[model samples]
Target: MSSKYSLPLVLSFTIHIVLAGILLLGDFSSPPKPTPTSVQMEPIQAVIVEKSKVEAQINKIKKQKADDAKKLKDLEQSIAAAKAKRLNEAKRVKELERQRKKKAREKKAADIASKKAKAKANAADKIRKQKEREKKQADEAAAADAKAKRIKEENDAKKAAKKAEDLRKKKAAELKRKEQEARERAAQQKLLEQQMAEDMANRQQARRQQMMTEIGRFTALITQTIKRNLITDRSTMEGKSCKLTISLAPSGFVTNVVTGQGNRIVCEAAKTAVYKAGTLPVSKDPEIFREMRTISLTVAPDKFN
Candidate 1:
């Protein structure tokens, strides 16, 4: 079957065929001739030699078979090792695929969460802006109301001031009119009194003129008597003419004497002569006495002078 056993079997069969042919061809005669003496070749001894050679060949074939068996076992071991290595590579590829899928799932979830958070923040900011806008509008409205109230108050104050000023002016004008009317009444009363007094004075003046002529004659008589009574060293009584006024009671007695236009010496002499007479010759009428209490006269030593 194997090349090692088949090669050894072919060589042994060919050697036996040749040894038999030589025996059959006359090889025994040649040996017998050399042994004309009868030499006995043992059949048992040939069988023993053939058996020994076959045993030796069998031993060699067994050794070769053992060596071949060992080589076959080694080749089987190498094939099993290569199959195990391929199985390990396939498992490693599967694990790497699983890891990649897991990582992709985690990244997708994170992106979704981030989008939601951003949206929530945007909504909060929008609400804040709306509230601010409302507050600003309310403040503006309040400010406008306050400003209007202030303007109204100022207008009312101006109207009140104008009303007060007008009332004051009207009161002042009324007081002035009353004062003017009072002064006019007083002036009219005074004018009426002055007119009545002037009428009474005119009647009294007519009687006083007649009584003054009579008193002048009596004064002349008294002067003549004093001139006769007196004696002087001087020859001429040269002096200025004197006029005098006299105030008297109704009884014609002198109350006081006043010189009008004369020297002091002549007036004193005239006054003394009137005193010696003791009473002036005046008007008998009471009305004439009231109007003629004062009189004026002139005196000189010589009549012409």
Candidate 2:
């Protein structure tokens, strides 16, 4: 079946064809010749010699066939051995290829893992740096705001203090002006009071002088009335006067008469005359009449005669 056994198989087939041709063309012999000396013995002897030579040639051909078959069997065994060796070599090559592929895959996987780890580490470092920068910026902004607020508060406090001082000075000036006005008003009031007191005293002295003159005029009129009504005896009443006290009503009606130290005769006569004259002259003004309600007089009848 294999090409390596082609020549051996062709050679074996040719030797088989040659052996069949030799068996088919076996030795041919002529009929036995008759001999005169011993007729039976010579012919029999010749036939036996021919048969033995043919048998010997047949034995030689069988031996050659056996040898060729033995050689063919040995060739087939050699070819089987060579086929087995080639199969074993192919199996060894396949196993080596599988080992190489597995090692290559393992190396590729390791390289990919290393790259991924490096990328992750770089990303984490970048994020941390960014956070630190943001924190620093926030702290700076807060400090700036605090400084501005402090400055504004200081300015406001100064303005408030200055305004308060201005208000205090204005109030003090107003108080001083009011005090000066009060002192001027007090001096004017004192001068006016002194002038009013002098005018009142001068008016009172003039009123007293006028009231004294009116009182003297009324007293002389009353004495003249009494003397006109007296009963006089000139010899005994000459140079003798009578003193009398009289009480009168609001309309000048004589109520009662009392005699005081004087001439008894003239006093009796005067008392009778006053009773006869029931009414007398009186002032209509209330202040003038208060002085004449009770009056004392000395009447002398000799003067009337």
Candidate 3:
């Protein structure tokens, strides 16, 4: 039992022990003595008086029993009041403990909820940052591709222009080469024409000189033919000299024969001998005709030998 209940039980037990000691020590050895009478003896009255004393004693004893019963009832009521007060105090303490536990549980649940909300917000922020980075990279790639394409186009245009200029220069060089070749050909042709004209003139000059030199051979031929036709009579002298001039046509026919210086008989004999030959000997060369058309002849037997 609790200390409060134990203290009340000890107090009740101590009071019971004191009441028992009082009962044990009180003297119950003789009844109350009869009230004393005067020293004169009366038998019947004395008996009656003794009986009255006994009845009075019995009445007092009954009254004492009633008082003891009321005291016992009062003690039992005090014990019940003490037990009720202890039971109410125990109930109040139990109710306070239960409220304290409930508050602790609510605080723990609220803390868990707050942590979960924070974690969700952090996840959303991370996703947004990743998307932004990806978009930035894609935009940079597109811009780079466009710039590369433009550079390639400009390079192609420059290459085409360079090719065209090179071709034009090549054509111009070819035209200049052809013109130079044509000029060379014209100069060569003019030189060839001048060389041909000089060669023709040299050939003609050589032929004229050759024909003039042949005149001596024609003179010899004429002298021999007239000597073969000599009809020398003994009357004509042997050592006489004769000179003659002969004329001829292109056909070598004697057109005229005349005596220049000699003895009369010898000159006359030479003229007759030339006529007897019917034609004088001359070169057939057209160039020699200029010398042979008219010729001079001398006949001295000593010199002609």
Candidate 4:
């Protein structure tokens, strides 16, 4: 038999033995107490006793005892078997409970592992998104900086080009003015040479030409001086001209200047320029004085005010 059923079988066998002893002892307990007796007259007769009848009574008693012992032994064996069977059922129930508890623990462990894995995945996704956002912002910042730098470079280049163009125009105008002055001087020198060679042929014509030559040279010098001092406002003096009557001393110093005719603003600008010059060019030749003193000079400019 299985070890778990051994104790219950033993206990059942002991209980059956105790019950059989109680039944046998109850049946043969000390003879019952003697009953009361009374005397009586009786007829006497001769009685015959048989040997075979006595032997048969003895054999019947022995057979009854053997059957009782056999019944008792069968009862003990049946009780023991029933008890062992009950103990086996109890063991089956306990084994099933242990299996149930083990399965429950395994399932709980699996659930915990699943939850941990899911949590890790969620954390990783959050970090990835954060890194992507930071990278996108960095890229946008770099692009904006590049755009601003390009705009600044283009503006600087435009300013440099405009400055160069203005300088080139200024230099060209200066070169043109010098060439014009040189040509005028050459013409004046040729005229003076022509008049010197023919002085005896026409004294009056030669004298007039000489005076004209002196006047032209002095006027050109005065124009150059005034041009340097003049500050023009195109809005005020565009397409305007003026005549100035100037009284000069023999020493090339101007004593007075008066506006003759033209726009008032143009005349005022011209007078201011003449005064700023402080003096006019004068010929040392006394004969040139008649035309130089109290002269009316036209102040006109085509390119500048």
Model 3: how far is 38 from its true place, Å? 99
The best candidate in terms of TM-score: 2
Query: How does residue 292 of candidate 4 score in lDDT?
Result: 90
Look at candidate 3 and give me any clashing residue pairs. none
Candidate 2 ranges beyond 4 A from true positions: 1-198, 300-305
Where does candidate 3 have its weakest 10-residue lDDT segment?
21-30
Candidate 4, residues 143-239, lDDT tens digits: the string is: 9999999999999999999999999999999999999989999899888888776775588778889999989989878887877877777777778
Name model 4 segments beyond 4 Å from true.
Answer: 1-201, 303-305
Q: Pairing residues by index, what is the TM-score of model 4?
A: 0.33
Clashing residue pairs for model 2: none
Sorting all predicted structures by lDDT, with the top scorer first, yields 4, 3, 2, 1
C-alpha lDDT (0 to 100) for residue 266 of candidate 2 = 92
**Candidate 3: Cα lDDT at 180:** 90
- RMSD per prediction, one decimal? 55.1, 56.0, 58.8, 46.9
Query: lDDT scores for all predictions?
Result: 0.66, 0.78, 0.79, 0.79
Q: Which parts of model 1 have CA positions greater than 4 angstroms off?
A: 1-128, 182-186, 189-305
Q: Report residue 271 deviation for candidate 2 (angstroms).
A: 2.6
Find the 10 residues in a row with the least total lDDT in model 2: 25-34
- Quick one: best lDDT, which candidate? 4
The true-versus-predicted C-alpha distance at residue 206 of model 4, in Å, is: 0.9
lDDT of candidate 4 at residue 86, scale 0 to 100: 80
Instruction: Let me know the TM-score candidate 1 reaches against the reference structure.
Output: 0.30
Q: Estimate each model's TM-score.
A: 0.30, 0.41, 0.33, 0.33
